[model samples]
Target chain A: MRHHKALFKFAIKAGEIMLRNGAETYRVEDTIERILRTQDLEIVESFVTPTGIFATMDEEDGETVTVVKRVRKRTIHLHKVALINHLSRQFVEGSLTLEEASQTLQEIESRKPYPPAIMIMSIGLAASFFTVVFGGSLRDFCSSLLIGIFLALLQQGFYNSRVSRFLVDLLGGSLIAVFALLFVNTGLGAQLDKIIIGSIMPLVPGVAITNAVRDTIEGDLVSGISRGVEAFFIAVSIAAGVGIVLKIWFAVNGGYIV
Target chain B: MILPMALQIISAFFATIFFSVMFNISRKELLYCGLSGGLGWSIYLISNQLGGSIVVSTFLGALAVSFLSRYLAILRKQPVTIFLISGTIPLVPGAGMYQTMYALITQDIEQAATYGSQTLQMAGVIAIAMIIISSLPKSAPEQRKAH
Candidate 1:
């Protein structure tokens, strides 16, 4: 039992190290596998976080069980590590405070909303819904809000940033474009504000700013700025498409465009 | 959405906790960070409902977050970033940006500029709010240090 606790602590420590270094999700898993293999330990299941690790393992497996293991090779440039080493050279010098080191590792951790990120996404959704219902006319509010909420809650393959950032941006922009194209021309034109803002809020990079700052602090200014610019443009394009449609409507029929 | 709103609040509540855990913050210090955010945003929504301008409401909302975060850092203990980030989510200028673009596409250069300005205003509102909220606590001490 005592040995189990000790191994568990070591596993956790190993997790903390990976997380702090900014290992992406799969990278973190590989790191843990490396640690377990080094210790000649048995593994059950492993998972990664923006923070650290969660895993279940038992040494008793050494007594009788054999499990098939699968491996894949992934290449990563430990940007965060080189960053920390460079920054530490400027200020404190020598070793990093465990916190700094851990954060650096977590920086390497690939992008995903830790569960709270999802909640933030959801709450922002709720807030958007509430904003429309309370502020705008009910009919315009509902249709636009429904579109916004659906886009947010859909959680389709659009969530994959690497595969679909541009695609999702295009789709989101086009969807809003189509909605505005169809409705803004009609007698009951909707609240453009409600439709555009509420729908696109889920994808904004408030988190990216926080991460970018961490990166800048750790000395990866180029990468940090690039990510920030990329995120900012995706947001801008989402707005641009919808804006174009609304502009056309205003030209055809002169009225206050909200 | 059913009970997901409440669940979201709960998730946000613990998300900060998870951040704290990873960042090496004390466990006891987490909930205040979440509360500070929720409270600030609630106030922003309430004031906006009462006919305050979005700009004014957002400023006050950010102030509310920063104030409590600063107070909690003194009375309790936690990073201001947690509450500030979470609180600012409600204020991010999403609507304004859309309106600006919508104005642009239809060739209403004037209105596009107008709403574009509004979007800029909104973005400015959040940007300043972010700077203020993040700096409010430090400003106090920095002032005294200069004196």
Candidate 2:
């Protein structure tokens, strides 16, 4: 009975880690089930959504346990997802003892993301390169690079603020437009539109949109709808951010510089 | 034209690499992510230059990205989402979304509607492309009940 309880806790912990790190709903459910089934449990089931996970298992002696883990935050860390996937596979293959598996999962859980300095630089470079991809000139690229750096800094500054993600994106979008306008107006950049577009690329909800579609296709309709709504709102916040700034600029300048 | 196309592809490769860093993908997989992004954007450019509409070109580009991601997932033993999300970044409708919102803010309702629907269509086609690729049957060895 104690062994079964430990097994259930371990499996649910693995699922929670996956869920918190942005694994798909079906993937989390599948991982939990695979891990639990390794012990010959009579009943094992897991239900996951974008926001929470519910799992229950039963033993042959009429001993049943259910655990519900509520996941409030999600960030894309595919490295963690891949690690947990590998761990679960090893556990299912019986190559790993339960203690070793749980210990490794603990280590994986505490793994930090890439260093902030590197992340900020990469965010800036991503925006600038995207500017070039969209046909921006060298001057525009330079301007976008600077704007991207500032946007990254802004996001980092707000990281611990507990503000809504949408608000951060909204501010990031406005900052991009403001910088683009200032650069173009001051003759530092040639294409205002290109610069704004490039810098905003970092804020786009590519992961959410893709995961939403994938979850829906995998028949996790609840996760799908919620993620789709997330993507839509993120897009809107970004647009509104840029739109408000552009509208104000146009009104002040009495012309369409966009 | 060829030079521009090559430039776009190269930029897309680097862009995707840095984007993957933001998503915290492991270091070893960064190069493959870049390769997939370059492949997707190259396909998009080629199809567009071949007279395909923007929507159709985007669909083809996403299709290529999805296929490459699945293949890389098997070869590298990583989750397919790691590649799929980063690779599709270059084809996402960020520019279109901006243009639509810009038109709307300027009170150009006609232009806004046009760009808005185009953006929606591009997003929709990308989703459909992913669904088609994911729904395809896998071979025996690589088969997993859940993807």
Candidate 3:
């Protein structure tokens, strides 16, 4: 009974790490069930959604243990997801002891994301390269590079705040538009639309949209719908942010700036 | 035209690499992510130049990315999402979404409707492509069958 309880803790902890780091719902459930089944539990079932995990392990001759882990925070850190995936597979394959697995999970959980400077530079370069992809010229690329860096700085500033993610995106969209407009109006950039589009790419909900579809297709209706709504709201917020700024600009300039 | 397409593909490669960095994908897998992105964008460009509709081209691009991600998931022994998320970044209709919002803000309702539907279609097709690829049988399902 004690061993079963420890195993349950390990499995749920692994699932929690995966969930909090943005693994898909199905994957988390699979990992938890796999971990629990390593001990020959007669009935092991796990239910995961975008926000929480519920699992029960029933042994034929032993007590049944149920665990519920509520996951509230999420960010895109695929490396952590992949690491837990590897760790769970190892534990299932019998190569890793329970203690080792728990220790590794702790390490993975405590792992920090890439340094802020590198992330900022990457974000800036991503925006600039996307400008080129969208047929922007050298001048437009330069402006987007600056805008992307500024946007990254803004995001870093908000990284520790308790602000809502959608509001951050809304602010991000407005920031991109504001900078794009500033550059164009000042003759430092050409093609306002291209710059805004490129800079906004960083803030789009690609992960949420993809995961929502994947979850839905895998028959996790609850997770799918919730993630889909998340994607929709994010899209709407970004659009609203950009729309408000452009509307004000249009009204002030008496015409379309582009 | 070919030169421009090549430029777009190369930029996609680097852009995906940088995006992967933001996603905290490991350094070892960054190159593969970049390759997947470049491959997907190349397909998008070629199909678009071949007169495919934007939606159809996005579907093909996403299809290619999904297959590549599955393959790399096996080859590199990593989760498919690492590659899929970054690979599909370029095809996620950010431009279309922006265009739609632009039209709406400018009170061009007709154009807004057109772009908005196109954006949704592109997103839908990408999802369908991923589903098709993921649902395909794996090499050794007997292991999964054991459960």
Which candidate number maximizes TM-score?
A: 2
lDDT tens readout by residue for model 1, A1-258? 455444454435544543454333333444444434434455556665343356666665454222322222211122332232233222223254434644544463443323534434443344345334234445554555455545554334444345545556656666665664455447343665555554565555554454444344334455457545755777776665565555556666776565
User: 1 or 2: which has the higher DockQ?
Assistant: 2
The root-mean-square deviation over C-alpha atoms between each candidate and the true structure, in angstroms, is 12.8, 1.2, 1.7
Kindly report which residue pairs in candidate 3 clash with one another.
Answer: none
* Off by more than 4 A, model 2: B144-147
The number of residue pairs in model 3 that clash at the backbone is 0
Clashing pairs in 2: none
* Clash numbers, per candidate: 22, 0, 0
Worst 10 residues of 1 chain B by lDDT: B18-27
**Number of the candidate with higher DockQ, 1 or 3:** 3
Q: Which structure is stronger by TM-score: 1 or 2?
A: 2
Model 3 / residue A69 / CA error / Å: 1.2
Candidate 3 docking DockQ:
0.76
lDDT of 1 at A94: 28
Specify the highest-lDDT model's number. Answer: 2
lDDT winner between candidates 1 and 3: 3
TM-score of each: 0.51, 0.98, 0.97
- Provide all candidates' interface root-mean-square deviations: 9.2, 0.8, 1.5
Chain A TM-score for candidate 3 is 0.97
Candidate 2, residues B4-26, lDDT tens digits: the string is 88998999999999999999999
Q: Which portions of model 1 show Cα errors greater than 4 Å?
A: A1-130, A137-145, A153-155, A160-164, A177-192, A209-224, A244-258, B1-57, B70-79, B136-147
